[model samples]
Target: MSTTSGAAGAAYDVAIVGTGGIAAIHARDLAELGERARIVTAVDTDAGRLDDFSRRWSVPRTYAALESMLEFERPDVVVLCTPPGLHTGQALTCLEHGVTVLCEKPPALSLAEMDTIIGAERADAGDGRFATVFQHRFGSGAESLRRLVGDPRLGPPMTAVCHTLWYRPDDYFAAPWRGVWGVEGGGPTMGHGIHQMDLLLSVLGPWRDVSAVAARRARPTDTEDFSAALVTFDSGVVATVVNSLLSPRETSYLRFDFAHATVELEHLYGYDDASWRVSAAPEHEDTVAAAWAEGPKGRGSGHAAQYTALFDALDAGAPPPVTTADARDTMELVAAIYASSFTGQTVRRGDLGPGSPFYDRMNGDGAPWAAAKETEVPA
Candidate 1:
């Protein structure tokens, strides 16, 4: 794992791992990157899927296994779009081989898994070669909001509401890992709501504690179909979080209340500048508008925006966006939400470790479904 610049310029040889729905997003985004990057190869266990991906993306090579891809092509980065359970192992292998990784959301199934991934990264110090696909962080809306949050013109962030309420039918969980705690981790809180929470954490900083409750009201799955939490950030800002897969009218919404303005984002999956609005106090109205006008504009929240930034960091020999440290913080928050919910107590940050039950598994010692009232899905 060395950060050797590829080609005479900054062009990188990229590889895609796991040709699934999310992988398609990465492949398409990488294709539009033009000369800045190239999809040298793609990997998947299914030959037919791999072949289709290779043909669709015009990737020069395809492999059924990661080992073969590393041994033969050995591209600059491996985009891990595999199952959540395989993330840590796959990421460790890539880092060990000196290959950078851009993994999808819920970076690791548990904090212990995250620690293992971080250890591998540390062993390859200067490499700093791991990044997660928290693409929401790169959009123009997030960029603008991050700027406003820092600027005193908006004042300190005081409170927020981060909600990811969407529907997922039982057939959607036929993929095996979708609803299980061992593989997919938690339900909506881990998979769906993580995006909004990541965006919220990006603005509010570290959370001090979380008090939450999880339930299985509609989905017939091993994991809780829904979870809600009250999170207190270290910055003194408190927020409410609701993660559910039973909402008929779906939305991924976040509202940040600052001293001078209220900034909100309402979108299902990805967001654009239009999806965000800022309501400023009378005295700070003009100032907030002016500050927001400073452009990081037009870019939509998707893999392209994030991938471009990741490639640029690699090009400049800098640590990429959504580093392991950052991912760990988000994962810890997820752990806290589960721990608090399952135990009926507020989970404080820094309390979870090897000694804590939630440290090794998101479900902790007890089963989430057992504690919550389970609802049977119709056949």
Candidate 2:
């Protein structure tokens, strides 16, 4: 998978496996790099996706599996674009061969599974970094929101909520792997909500406790169509999160109420779209507006932001945009919610931290460590 620059990319720095839905984004972003980022090889279980990817990206080689591609390509970076369940094993393969990986979210089916890859990364910590796809972090407006959180003058966020209300056609879940617990893992929360959930976790860190309820109210998906949770942060911030593939009209939004101001992240999660609004409370609204006229605030969304960050890191020999440690925290949050909802209790974040029950459980196997609940994702 050696590469020479013709056009579209500066030099070859990485290989991408799994040329599926998200792979297109990686390819397009690399192409747009205009000689900055290149895809050395594209591996896929589907020969057809490889064919399309090769013609589209001007990539030189394609493989049906990671081993062949890793040995053949020996690229500096590998992207795990496969489904969440396949990440743990594939990432380990890439890491063992000295390839850095930018894996998509829910990096492994379980925290235990991710440990295998994380363990390797720890051993090789200074060697190369493993990153997860919590791409929403790159959104243009997100940085502005972060600044807002740190400003005490803006007041503390009293409440925050994330909503992923979107439409999923019957055919969307027609793929057995999608709706099936074994292959896909969890429902809307696990599969779709993970990204926004990461954003939530980023804004409200150290979630102290969580209580959740999940149910498959609509859709044939084996997992829940809808799930809701109430979380308490170690910072004393409270959050309510709800996600679903069951809604008719699509709506994706995040909002927070601070003592002096209110910030609402609207349309931040719908595919190919987003918007946000931030204002001071009525009493402080005027003063905030006066300060706001000083400048504009916001960030990027989706593959556009993520792909650029991922490639730039690979090019400079820097760490990927979102680290594996970031992913672990997000997954632990999900695990806590699942545990709380499934066990009929509230889950504390410390329970999933180092030396906790879930810390060493994964041992990095891609195979399912725990069976999916015939009902909801496990706690």
190-305, model 2: which lDDT tens digit per residue? 78888888888887677889898777666776666778999899888888999889788877778888888877777735332237666777778776655444433443576657
**Candidate 1 local lDDT, 29-91, one digit each (tens):** 876777768888889999998898888888888888898888887687888999998888888
Error of 2 at 18 (Å): 1.0
How well does candidate 1 match the true structure, expressed as C-alpha RMSD?
A: 3.1
> Candidate 2: misplaced stretches above 4 Å?
1-12, 268-274, 290-299, 311-318, 353-379
Query: What TM-score would each prediction reach against the true structure?
Result: 0.94, 0.86
Clashes of each: 1, 14
Quick one: best lDDT, which candidate?
Answer: 1
Score candidate 1 by lDDT.
0.87
Question: Which 10-residue window in model 1 sums to the lowest lDDT?
Answer: 1-10
What's the CA error at residue 281 for candidate 2, in Å? 1.9
